[model samples]
Target: MKDINEPSTAPLVIADEPVNSEVIKTTTATAKNSSNKKSAGVSSQMQLLALAKNFVLDGGLVSSDKQMPLEERTQKRARIAALRKQENLEAIIKKSVNYCSATEFTNKADADWFSTFTELAEDVSNTTMQNLWAKILAGEISQPGSFSTKTLKVFRAMSITEAKLLAKACSLAVTEQTKRNIRIISGAYQTPGLLNFFSKNREQNITFSQFSLSYADLLILADNHLVFIQETESNPMNKSESFHFNFNGKPLTLTANKSSCVLKFYKFTPIGSELARLISDNIDDTYLQHLKSALSENFSIIEG
Candidate 1:
């Protein structure tokens, strides 16, 4: 895998209108009285102008009005963009902090924090947010060091199949592992077309009836390692034909006539971890207690 920290050779492009200095001056004065404490830093005329200039890049006017100087307009636009970016970064940080502090299963605080994060991630249009969330979830599921490097790589794979493939293809390029894992996991379906169907339609909506049936088959294959086979018995019933060994150290039970599978594993106590960290961090216990109560009231574990 390429080192994430490597600087890209791609060009940086900024195509936006210039900032309006007069507007910044006026906005800063009004921001002084605003309840948003963060914006107060731009209240000073000099600070506001500096911020505007720093934010705005090219010498472009905020408005097409020929009366306004291009520099001032550029400054204004830059300031607005900078402020928006600052707000987004702050929100992400706050969400991450809150997520790290969560202490129980189904905590509303954590859920709320993650929801905010997901929104921000969508806005940012990047994989970083998803990666972070996956890491956090994995941490919650297993003890530190319990998850192998391969498992972590699988966690970061593009999809469930990709993750499994990556686990199996440790000898090859990291990118290929995910694809290989998917093939391995889906290899045993007696219906030879199942893999091809998933490959082609993973991103689309199919007929509801077909989707329902396929979903059941996929679930059985994924959870119970079963392969569905054709038969003739007046009314041949679909039965799970197991072909793989259970590796997760759990009793695997097939239910709903091979439509569902469940496994029992040690649950991670996220709430407990959060609580301990919060107490140690000396943050206000009241917020922590409130979040704990809310989560307890809302979430229930659906074992599978």
Candidate 2:
């Protein structure tokens, strides 16, 4: 976060290398051109990328062949590349903000988010350039709010698609609550060692496999700390023997079955809860209420 204003990198300039200076000078023209005309946007972006590369190569060069030893040159170049990449990322975020101005969702809030992300650009990965840009655009073109800088920083390092899938899966994992916590049915997954719930009342067991989520996707959420997990033998009372959820608007009945005593699963962490609140929508509220009511019918809190 060093200010770009602290005495330009003039000392790093080599007398013979005027190309870097020229490229740097043209950046203003490119940015201005992109700002003034939407038609030239593509060309402007290309130039910005080019200039970014040029800055790294030019900025890292030793003033004289003997000024720095050859052994350290590679390391110096690597550091310069990271700094240069960050600079380029700033440019990209800027362009995304400019493009947002024409969209219905664009507002001062979006601008603030953009600026926040821009400040944190240096820490984000640039490998998924297109995806990053798309996510940025999506944020701007929708509800804009101040996301947790720390949370988003971790998110920026992760795959956007995976984060989205995890979000969707969490939405589907809802179940009518009882004294025991709900275990989502392992739909489409014939994986062994799945400990689930079964009905003790009627002959039928509930399974809402229609709203299935991949086990792998849920694992990713756990890995990203967006969800929590624990592995143990089922010990809670009035839990389930089979892992099934009610698709119909009926209370899901569950009993503990001794078929698979071993268990490995995810539970929510504090951070995971925070993420769920951010990602989950009002669509799940009714379902949650149903679960709570069902649980309250049979479960009660014990006071010490």
Q: Rate the local accuracy (lDDT) of all candidates.
A: 0.32, 0.45
Q: Can you write out model 2's per-residue Cα lDDT over 65-122, one digit (the tens) per residue?
A: 3244555656777877788667667666665565454536444455556666665565
- Taking all chains together, the TM-score of candidate 2 against the true structure is 0.36
For candidate 1, write residues 1-304 as lDDT tens digits. 2112222344434338644656645554454344234433333443433444455532332344533576766667767766765565555455455544346453223444444434443333123434344444434333343333333232333343333322222211011112211111111111224444455322211121221224443343333222122211112214442222222221222221231122111111222122111111123234323322322211211212
On lDDT, the leading prediction is 2
Per-residue lDDT of 245 in model 2: 40
Q: What is the lDDT of residue 249 in candidate 1?
A: 22
lDDT of 2: 0.45
Worst 10 residues of 2 by lDDT: 1-10
The regions of model 2 sitting more than 4 angstroms off are 1-107, 110-116, 122-134, 137-142, 157-220, 228-304
* Candidate 1 ranges beyond 4 A from true positions: 1-67, 102-209, 212-304
lDDT of 2 at 228: 52
